[model samples]
Every structure is written in C-alpha cells, then in structure tokens.
Target chain A: MTQHTTGAYDEELRDLVSRIAEMGGLAEGLVSEAVTGLARIDIARAQNVIFNDHRLDDMQRQVEERAISVIARRQPVARDLREIIAALRVSSDLERVGDLAKNIAKRVIAIDGQFHTKRLAFGVEHISEITLEQLKAVLDAYTSQDLDAAHAVRSRDDEIDAMYTSLFRELLTYMMEDPRNITFCTHLLFCAKNIERIGDHATNIAETIHFMITGEYLQEDRPKQDESSYIPAGYSSE
Target chain B: MTQHTTGAYDEELRDLVSRIAEMGGLAEGLVSEAVTGLARIDIARAQNVIFNDHRLDDMQRQVEERAISVIARRQPVARDLREIIAALRVSSDLERVGDLAKNIAKRVIAIDGQFHTKRLAFGVEHISEITLEQLKAVLDAYTSQDLDAAHAVRSRDDEIDAMYTSLFRELLTYMMEDPRNITFCTHLLFCAKNIERIGDHATNIAETIHFMITGEYLQEDRPKQDESSYIPAGYSSE
Candidate 1:
C-alpha cells in the first residue's frame, strides 16, 4: 500500500518531500544568484552563493539519513520505496547543482575587475536563465509528482546543450581574436560549462521523476545537442 | 550477530561486494586508457574508452537495482544496511569516474590531428596516474573494508588539486604567449579539470567508506588545496 500503517511513517515521508522542495529552492536561488553575480561581477553576491552551498550539502545529508532511517525502520516498498529513492536521487542532484553554481560563483570572483568585455557575458547569462528555468520546472515536477512536466524538462535539455555549444564557440573566438581576452574568456568558458552541467542535473532529476512514477528507468538516450566536443580545430561550421 | 541467518541474504550481500569490485576495475581501466589515449593522442584508444563507458553505466545500474532489491526484500538493518548503502555510493562514484574519463577521451578525439605540444600532455598524464592510483587504492579498501586505506586516499586528494592549479597556470601562460596554443591548451585545461574531478570522486568514495565503517558522516570540511579559483589574472605566483 502507498499509505503506511503508522502515522509516523507517513509523517516521515512528507518530511522528505518538503525537504527536497527546500533543497530545490536553495539550489535554484544559488544558480540564479551565481549567474547574476557573474553577469554583474558582484563579488559579494558570488561569495554569498559560495557560502550558502554548505546548507544545501547539509540538507542533502539530512535527506539521505532520513530516507535510510525510514527504510530500515518502516520497511517501505512499492511506491513508498520509490518515493524514498527519488528523494535520495533528487537531493543528490540538487547538491551537485549547488556545486555547479558555486563553481560559477568562484569564477565570478576569479574574473572580478578584470572583466571589461560586456558583450561576452550576455550569452552566458542567456544560457543560465534557460537552465534556471529548467531546474525550477523539474523541481516543481518532483513536488507535484507531475510526469508530463518532467518529460518536458528532459526533452528541453538539448536546448541548454545547444546554447552552451554556441557560447563555447563564442568565447574561444574572442580569446583567439585578442590575446588579452584569453584569461577572462577561459574563466567564462568554465562558467558556461558549469551552467550547462546544471542543465544536465535538471535532466537527471527529470529521469528520477520518471523512475518514481513509471517504476522504470528512462531508457532513451539523452538527446545531446552540444557538438562542441567534435567542433573542428579550425572553427569552421562546415 | 554479524552473520545473517538466511543463506540468501548473505548471498545477496556477497554479490553486491563483488559487483562493486567489478565496477571499480572497469572504471580504473577506463581512466588509464583515457589518459594514455590523451598522452599518446591515440584516437583509437580514446574511441575505445568512450565505447567502454556504457558498460560501466550498465554495471552501475545493476549495482543500484540489486542494492535496492536487497534492501526492500531483505529489510537489512545496522551493518548490513550500511554495507548495501556503501555499494550504492561507491557505484555512483565509479560511474562518475567513468564519465570523467570519457570526457577526457572525447577531447582526445576533438583535438585529434591538431595536437603537437608534448609537454602539456605529460603534466596531464602525471596527474591522471596519481588520481588513478588513488581510485584503485580506494576501491581496494572498499573491497577489503580497510578503513585506513580509505583515510589515506582521502588525505592525498589535495595533491591532485595542487597539480591541477599549476597546470591551470601553465595552460593559461601558453595561451597568452601564443594564440596558436589557445585551442590545444584550452582542451588540455579541461582535461586537467576532468582528472581533478576524478580525484574528488575518489575522495568522495573515501568519505563513503568512513561513513560505512563508523556509521557517521565525516563532518570536517575537506582540506581543499586547489586555490586555482583565486589565482590572479596576471598569472604571477604572487
């Protein structure tokens, strides 16, 4: 049965759901703030993002401990078991997302005052916004147990990958154009990579949701649109 | 009390330990081949690394499924529960290690015919070998339940971080010195990052071992040595 015999067990499950939601919110805010920090070069905001990640990490640990405790004590099976598993998976994803955000924030500090290229920052921000939306939607899907929303998030992952490809190309071109831009562009490229990875984590959460609902792993290969990996050394689109 | 009464439960636990060892071996081989491929610019070898990652993925899936099945069916408690949990955590870390290796291999393919600088490749290989050894030691610890070896792996992680920071500087200097070095150095930089991340995953596995044995999360903040984040734009060691 989905409902446990004891009220205490049900209460524990509810706590997991809420904890995941909290973690999601924290992770999302970190991503948004990190990108904002990078785009605006706000050192304090980026440092704040860095400082705040430990909270997410702690919450993730709490979620895992709670889930394991509930499993051993309650012997949950079927949907209840899946719910616990999903909580574990999603919290881990959020923790990784937090790390990605922190990576971005770290680069924000690394490039502080050295960044004069305003135009290059916009593409990074644009991709960040899309990834932020994707992360938000997937987390919402988890709270509502909405399968369709999760699938949509999974399908849209390629969009983030595509944007990251273009951003990678753009940064490399800027670095090539002027030797002075090399250091900043390299840092920006990493920031874009961090953002792109956040999008992958969103897709991972979406897959976790799929597993929770359908009781099967999402079997289709991820439609990866980022071909920057195979881009020619010559930078020719041909 | 350590031994379960049922023959099947003990069998399941043994299977999990063996699977983890198997996954560890596969992950280690992939990392070795990827670095070798990177250093030698061996496209065929890199392609093999990329192709072999799916096997690691499949084994990780089996480890998780089996762990979950045993948990639900056996309702293991205490040490048994921790053992199963360790399997899950280790498999996940190994899967990530596989991904990092595959990423390096992908870059190997990306820069296929263009790579000429030999020195850049050597530093990467040096770091990779150290990280690979750490991974092997950690996996052996996991298999033998040797807490001491795990602790050793955990402590040496900063060495990899230091190497990565220096490599980061080296790549940037090369890029600045000659624009022709930009693309190759950029790719090398990412390869170094992937290796550094593999080190982190090894450290993560070490922490998992600590948790498995002591039944408490390692609460101390990791000794992070990679201060590449704060390295100045001017590339001066000062």
Candidate 2:
C-alpha cells in the first residue's frame, strides 16, 4: 500500500471514532437531563430529553454505515478489524442508553404532579449521580483503550445494583403504606430500574473496551447484587 | 472471482446464517419456558431458562467473531456487507431477548409461593403468547428476507403494548383490593414488563430485517399505546 492510501485509511478511522465520541456525549447528556428532570419534576426538560433522542439515533446510523464502509474498503485484519467491531458494538450500546434515558423521561410526564416525596426523590438522585459517573468513566475508557479503567467500571456496577435494590425496597414500603401512593411509586420504580439498566449498558461498554484491547472477553462473571424482587422465607400473608 | 472462491464464500455465509438461526431457536424456547414456568410456578423450568441464557450469549459471541472474520477475508460490499451487519444486530437482539427471559425466570423464584392469582397468571400467559408469536414471525422474516412479513411484525407491536396497559391496570386493582397481594402483584408487574420489552426487541429485529432487505429504515414512527402510567385527569386523592 502507498503512503497516501495508509494516510486516507487512518483519516477515515479517526472520523469513525469521533462520531462515536459525539454519540457517547449525547447519550451521557440525555441520561443526566432525564434524571434531573425526574428529580425536579420539570416537564419541559424531560420533553427536551425525549425530543433529542432522535439525534443519537441518527448518529448511530451514521457510525454504523461508516464503519461498514471502512471494513469493506480496508479489509482490515486482526486489531483493525477488532477495533471496527468494537466501535459497532459500542455505538449500539450508546443508542440503547439513549432509549433507556428516554424511557425515564416518559415516566416523568406520566407521573404528572400526582405526588411528591422528598426522600424518594433523593434516592433517585443519588443513584443517577453514580450511574452518570460510571457512564462517563466507561466512555473515556473506550476512547483511550484503558483496560484498567474499563475493569474498574465493570467492578463498580454492583454499587449501582445494591443501590437499586434498596430503592426498590423503599418504594415498595411507600406503596404499602398508602393505596394512593401506589401509582406514583410505581412510576418511580420504573425510573429507577431504567437507571439500573443504563448502568448495565455502561458495564457492557466496559467489556467491549476490554475486548477491543485484548481481543478476549472479560473472563469473570459480571458482579451483580440486585435481588430486590426476591421474597424472603417465612413471610406470612396477611 | 473463480467459481470455487464464490462457492467457499457462500458456504461461509450459510454457516453464519445457521448460527443465527440456532441462537434464535434457543431464545424462542427460553421465552416459552420462562413464561410457562411463571404460569405454572414451576421452579425447575424457570431455573432451566436461567441456565440456558449463557448458551445464547456464547452463540452471540461466535456470530460476531465469525462476521468480523468474514469481512476481513472477503471484504464483502453492498448487499453482502449489509447481510453480515444484519446478522450481528440480530444476534445481539436475540441475546437481549434471552436476558429478558432470564429476568422473568428470576422473578418466578422471587414470588416464592406467597400468592398465586389465576387471573393475573392468565394475563401474563396471554401477553407472552403474543410476544412469542411475534418473535417467531420476525425470525422467519429474517431467514426468508420477506419484507412484508417483517413489516407485519413491526405493525403488531401496538397490540402487545395495549395488552400490557390493560394488565398494568388489572394488577394495580388487585394490589389495591388486598395489601397482602402487593408483593405478589409487584413481582407479576415486573414479569409483565419483561414480556413487553421482549415484544419491543421483536420489533427491533423486524426493523433490522427490513433494513437487510431494502437498505432503508422503516420511515414511520413505532406505534405505541402504553398509557397506564399517565395520571388521569380530575382524579381526587383519597
């Protein structure tokens, strides 16, 4: 291959990476805004998050097409091929992150001023803060191909899972306390689950980053502690 | 390209398709068993579903690696390239379907013989039946590259959404009637949701099939009718 050909190939790869970066940024912003809107009960901001998801979708389509084109043109083997596959997988994960965020935004509109509980809102905010941080760190790991950072994000997901389990218990107690609270708490529970799923997506990207660097899957089982739905022994029905 | 070269390429493509088909079959079976386990409260069947999910994950990894290897060796362009990309996307969707089924299986163990309402179980069975049908139809469409069949699957998602909304309302009513039913009904709600999300994944595959055949996205917005979360107007708090 000529020097000029190699230069053009490198340039195309850079463009693909930049597009993924842009999509990642959009996804991160959407999750943050959706959680904020939920916390503040701000309909307009939630609406904004919902409306902006189309952009992430469009960017994902673009990245996919460009990646395919590069593969066809370059016929890149080994590491280059792995990198392209990683980009494709990461883009899909980010697009899903956008959809989960949109689901949370939709819940905000659904709740619609029926009830407000400060402590419950605090629980959601705390979980969202940790999830957002994990997403940011994972995206950075992908950009830098930092294996250790990616492993760190993967290890830390149990924190989000544990938090989600506690929130689930609290919401269930809230609902059991009063029938009127049932509808409101149900929506909050879904919102919290969406956040938890977003954390899972972040962990997925972390694994993808690890694979991209090593061409091997993370050998250990994903650490998970979420057991909120489990029923305890000897709990008698009223 | 020589006839031998073309023959080898076709063989490789066939192998890839067959792997996807195998994964699809496994995912379909898992959904069926998980829902049946829930309906019958059979712990063994539910545990079987949980155990089977790892196979789908392994199949997905194999599909991805094979697809990347094919692209590197063949540099397939245009339709061939699209087909490989479609395979990757479909495998991912099937893997997620497997995860959602595992989630239902987990919920089966969680409810733990506390309460078993026949009517609620019937509702879940009904929704799972429809979603399983959709998955079957979409997989068939992908295998045959039948655009019309794919579009039909995409159009039928609204039916699942409507069913989910009714189930949500029914479950809430049960919870309100007896506080003792709260724990059972909440777990049922999550199970119903996992089925609804499986429907969404089927729709996603339908769209992917359409793209593989036509190289264009379905232009219309996805039809949605889930409004159970919406707070009703003029509802006074008790």
In TM-score terms, which candidate is top? Answer: 1
Residue-level lDDT tens digits of model 2 in A63-173: 888898888788888777788888888998999999889988888887666665646667888999999999999999988889999999999999999999888887777
Which 10 consecutive residues of model 2 chain B have the lowest summed lDDT? B229-238
What is candidate 2's CAPRI-style docking category based on DockQ? acceptable
Report lDDT (Cα) of residue B121, candidate 2: 77
Counting clashing residue pairs in each candidate, in order, gives 0, 0
* Per-residue accuracy of model 1 over B1-238 as CA lDDT, tens digit each: 5657898889999999999999999999999999999888889999999898989889988998899899889998888999998899889899999988988889888887774586767888899989999999999999888999999999999899999998899888888877777888888888899999999999999999999888989964887756677765445323
- Give lDDT tens digits, candidate 1, residues A27-145: 99999999999888899999999899999999999999999999999998888999998899999999999988998888888888774586878899999999999999999999999
Fraction of the true interface contacts (Cα pairs closer than 8 Å across chains) found in each model? 0.52, 0.33
Error of 1 at B88 (Å): 0.9
Q: Assess every candidate by TM-score.
A: 0.97, 0.94
| Candidate achieving the largest lDDT | 1
For all candidates in order, the CA lDDT equals 0.88, 0.84
